[model samples]
Target: MTRTAQVVVIGGGQAGLAAGYHLRRQGVDFVILDAQTTPGGAWQHTWDSLRLFSPAAYSSLPGRLMPPQTGETYPDAQHVVEYLADYEKRYELPLQRGIRVEAIHRDGPLLRVQTDSGAWHARAVISATGNWSRPFLPAVPGRSVFTGRQLHTVDYRCPADFAGQHVIVVGGGNSAAQIATDLTLDDHVNVTWVTQRPPHFLPDDIDGRALFDVATARRRALDAGRDDTGGVASLGDIVALPPVRKARDAGLLQASPMFDRMDRDGVVWADGTRAEADAVIWCTGFRPALSHLAPLQLRGTRGHIATEGTRAIGEPRLHLLGYGDWTGPASATLIGVGRPARDAARQITALFADN
Candidate 1:
């Protein structure tokens, strides 16, 4: 027998949980399918001391609030996971953990979701798999020849693990900066950061407002066609920027270019500078994993399904959240995904009424 739901949400992170919560409040029949054994997605895999750059107030799921961290810069990864657990428990949301969805196929007006457990025939499906599905590592020459330990940031756990070793951190993102900063504190570990661009470090807090407000405004401007610049927000232009530049001045981080290749000893920069190190931590960004949705037509430059509102460009009844900056506030963060999810729920409800 083919089980049915008005909507089937994929992944159980903050985005998926918020979507499910809203759907439940709307009295819609839906199921959340997650690949992990629990919720919280990438946060579940983050390092022990990892804290969100965004504060607990802004970094929360819908309905349930993040616990008060007493003016702390951010909540650690474990706290984030516990918050998601609380959100699920409070709402009594229907989520199926440890269910690896194999593929999504079309069957009449419904979408057929095939997983390791079983199949779901849903009228509508929200692809909340998120942007971190696959880590993006640049293909550098001689990467395989390096005699040091190489790992993506996803696998990094703690600085203690890398103690008494020379570590090279690659990429200029916040994650790379945080990891390098943590590792540099280790007396036994020598840390070097390599990246193509100097990061625009925003402050953790600003004049009583959370630092995310500036980011949110930048995103809103980008969405409103006010900001023509390509996604890079400089620190000076933003309000109450953090002391990241001070850290740079203190020689905590050395600005450098993208890694060119791996030397026999360690790593070579694009500028032909070489450093012998014990390990390289790649903090490159991530890409959405939609391998299961091969049947759905994705119209973007890359194969991302182009969406205007909740409607998929080519395929009907198939919706995507967290694709790019397409839907206003729909692709930015956990809060952004809610609008599209609610739109999707309403669309699904209307579709059900017609039947």
Candidate 2:
């Protein structure tokens, strides 16, 4: 027999938890299906040294503030994982672990969510599976020929393994910068930062809080039907973490333009300059993990399902949460995700109310 729920939330990450929180508040009958065996979602997969740009208080989900970091100003990846686990336990949210959702499709008026464990017939489905699983590496010419070690940021752990090697870190984002800086800490490791364009860095004092404020403003402007060019910091702009700041002070944050292609041992620049390297760390970011929704034929260009708020366009029973700004402004972030999740919960509640 197929199990049933009023709602099924895919992914038990920050977004999924937030959505679950709101759903619980509204007395909605929902179950969050998480792929991972443990809690903390993608936070469990990030590198050990990775720290949030915001303090613990600022980087929290709905109904619960992340417990303050004792000695650390910013919470590390492990801390986040613990916090998420505690939040799950504290709220007693109904989350099923190790249930990887394979596909989602419409079953008459309800949605059918198929997982490795079983199927869930849900009145509404929230796809909160954030972008962690979909690391994107650009199609560079001769990438297939490179014999040296190559991995995306998702696979990166620490710079210790890369010690005494020439490493090329790709992309201009914070992840790229941070990884490059981390690699530079070991004198034996030669690091090169590559980007399509010069990276933009926010002011030293500006952290995740400021970025969240800017995002909130942009969201408000867009909601008011106005242009959202508020001249504030962008999510792509690098925040000046202590280590990043130290790296900049020591003249280590310099970035080079993207290389032309890859050779067997290294990368080749457009100017025909060749840099021999042992590894290429692609921090080119991630694409939305919405493949399960493919059966619905809801994906538009670039694998994105067009969304008004959290609800998928042309498919009212489906909602895409915590993917990115396209779903809702800064919906990918911890704090920003709450807005769309709450809105989705409200809408879903109203739909049930109508019946």
The candidate that wins on TM-score is 2
What's the number of clashes in each of the models?
A: 1, 0
Give Cα-based local distance difference scores for all models: 0.73, 0.89
lDDT of 2 by residue, 64-121 (tens): 9999889999889999999999989999999999899999888998899998888999
Off by over 4 Å in 2: 230-236
Worst 10 residues of 2 by lDDT: 228-237
